[model samples]
Target chain A: MNVLYFAWVRERIGVPSESVETQAATVNDLVEELRAREDRYAAAFADTSALRVAVDQELTDFDAPLAGVKEVAFFPPMTGG
Target chain B: MRIIVQEAPFDFGQQAQAFASGRQNMGAIVTFTGVVRDDASGALTAMEIEHYPGMTEAALTAIANDACARWSLGDVLILHRYGRLTPGEMIMMVATAARHRRDAFEAAEFLMDYLKSRAPFWKREVTAEGASWVAAKDEDEAALDRW
Candidate 1:
């Protein structure tokens, strides 16, 4: 799956997107895998409450199933108008 | 319905005129433009807007379609700009056309409300001190509950 980040999350993670090989079944499980990878990932995922998730470009919760998902994006709450 | 997500500046007046013209059945047209506001400190330099390339258009289209489904709208136009924008520049605009003013006005408002929180765009305000991401306001989220 391809994992993406935006805004401050991207800044903290030091990359916009990455291809990840994971056995996670849900968004939360994927976050855990990434968070355990490095300190930067841990710092970015340190406080999930300040973050939002989208699976396959659709807004969804962290607990959303990642079955057959191709992309996952994490970012701050949108501030557009 | 038209949805445009671009990095270049758009001519609001031209777009507004074009959207309102040649519409005999639509009696009313309401357009709203959002500007990049400078901070009170006056040290702000630019507003950098970041958005997901594929999801931005999809999200805006879905929101506009929802407005059309809920209201008696003739047409809907949404234009949002990304990249570095200086203060006083236009950030985005939404125009709604309907047979009645009520529908046009309400639908335009609905588009604005949803575009604010639901869209995938994020804004970072650049100032002399530093650049920081704009935090989403609680009121913006609460505003959606009224609809």
Candidate 2:
């Protein structure tokens, strides 16, 4: 699956986008998997309280299922005027 | 109800005039423009906006539709420009028309909030130091919660 980052989220993660092979079943599970990888992922996922997720272009919660999801985007809320 | 996503510049006066001309009973017109900032507090210098082709359009269309459904809006126009944009460049514009000022103002504000938090565009900025991606802000998402 492809995971994308935006704004400061990309900076914290060290990459704008990445394709990872995972065995996660839900968005929260994926976050946990990434958190296990290293410090960068841990920092990015450190405060899931401040982050928002979208799966396959639809806004969803972290606990949402990602069984067949192709893309997952995580970012701070949004600040567009 | 027109939605445009392009990299070109637009004329707000012309757009507002056209919208007003078409509506005989509209009493208010509200518009909002988002400009590209010269700096993103060191995160970005020059910025490029990337979006999911079909998904971007669909998401924006749905936002505009949602605005129309919630308000007594007469017409709505949303234009977001992508690609590489310089500082002070216009990033997007949203205009709304309604029979009353309150409805027009609230709808316009609501539409902008929704687009900011829900749109699929990703922005990467370049500076003299290096290039980095911009992250969404918590405040931006919180703004929509009021509506």
Error of 1 at B89 (Å): 0.3
- lDDT of each prediction vs. the true structure? 0.96, 0.82
TM-score list, all predictions:
0.99, 0.76
Per-residue alpha-carbon lDDT of model 2 for B1-147, expressed as tens digits? 998888778787787677678677998989888888874564455668776555678888899999999999999998888888877778888899999999999999898888876887777777888776677776886887898
Q: Point out where model 1 deviates above 4 Å.
A: none
Q: Which digits, one per residue and each the tens of the lDDT, describe model 1 over residues B1-147?
A: 999999999999999999999999999999999999875857789999999999999999999999999999999999999999998999999999999999999999999999999999999999888989999999999999999
TM-score of 1: 0.99
- How would you class the docking of model 1? high
How does candidate 1 score on lDDT? 0.96
Residue A71 local lDDT, model 2: 88
lDDT, candidate 2, at B84: 85
Candidate 2: share of reference interface contacts reproduced: 0.39
Predicted complex 2: DockQ? 0.33
Clashes of each: 0, 7
